[model samples]
Target: MSRLLGLLGGTFDPVHNGHLRAALDVCEAGQLDQLRLLPCHIPPHRQTPRVDAATRLQLLQAAIHGEEPRLVVDDRELRRDAVSYTVDTLHSLHLDFPAARLCLLLGTDTFNGLPSWHRWRELGELAHLVVMQRPDFSATDDPVLARWMRERRTEDWTDLRAEPFGRVLFQPVAQLGISASLVRQRLAAGRSARYLVPEPVWQQIQQQQLYAAP
Candidate 1:
């Protein structure tokens, strides 16, 4: 079987517990050899983060420090000056490890809004989409996406293991109602974001005095 490399990209403004849990859960579920947590330099879909890219990268480094074997911090997107598009990142990964199977991890919310993304259709050709199911939305709610899901969805993990790319997989993960925005809100309001983020990450944010003001 070909090796599986998972990519989980986000702004990772503070790298919270929800992000860690989902990454760990998906690594086990997908049987990935290593999962790279990519922090986006610029997000086209949302407002620019209050925290700078450097700080976010530092926080990501801190969050993934002891998670070496299963998780690693990927700074490719941060190094790229242009807007961080998922397809572009996948294409780069495909080039770097052409023989290994590349899986792009995404939440259900992001998957549902795929049409709005830059060159979204080409994403499947570059890497397999592993959409983690969320409670608020379903693929069937969007007819176009539902049809695409029907055509490309894979039921067998072995099939993913055999191929290098081009398939979609829906996974059920623990529903944690935590988000980066919420974590920022709590911190900015001078409340405890202690359990929301990892210890090292929390310490870094506290020491740097980040997100103390809205």
Candidate 2:
């Protein structure tokens, strides 16, 4: 049987609890064999990460240390000296794990903005999209996205595992009101970010004086 692999890509400027919680929720709920946290070198839709790639990777490693064995870090995007497009990443992952079913995790906001991504139309060919539904966010308003969702959406996890790609699943995950930007702001303002991020990540930030006000 093919393994069910989950991919969660982000800048991960400081790898916080919200990310971990959502990942854990999806891993358990979807019965994923493994979930990789991919840190991008350059995010296409958002501003550059506040921390450098190496530092961000370090924080990510620190955050997941000894937490969940399945939640491992993949630095392929950071290693590549080019734009971190999800399409390219998926292609590479397909090459690496041909038999594994790929599930690309996304938040509702990211799913809604999918039309604007590089080679967005080709995404379904590479991996299944698992949109993590949050209580505060609603379904996509874009007609194109809505139609796409209607056409490919699957209510069952088995449907995703049965195929290597070309399916969409909206999963309700634990909603934590935490953002990396909020963590950075607190650190920059000399406020504590103890509970916002993993303890090791918070310690690393303090030790390195990362995101401190200029």
TM-score of 2: 0.97
Model 2, 176-209: lDDT tens digits are 8999899888988999999899999889888999
Q: Estimate each model's TM-score.
A: 0.96, 0.97
Name every residue pair that clashes in candidate 2: none
RMSD of 1: 1.2
Candidate that scores best on TM-score:
2
Candidate 1 stretches greater than 4 Å from native: 135-137
How would you encode candidate 1's per-residue C-alpha lDDT over 22-103 as one tens digit per residue?
Answer: 8888899888999998999999999898899999999988888888978988899999999999889988887888888888
What are the clash counts of all predictions, listed in order?
0, 0
lDDT on C-alpha atoms for all candidate structures: 0.87, 0.92
Kindly report which residue pairs in candidate 1 clash with one another: none
Q: After superposition, how far is residue 88 of candidate 2 from its true place, in Å?
A: 0.3
lDDT of 1 at 121: 79
Superposed on all Cα atoms, the candidates' RMSDs to the truth, in angstroms, are 1.2, 1.0
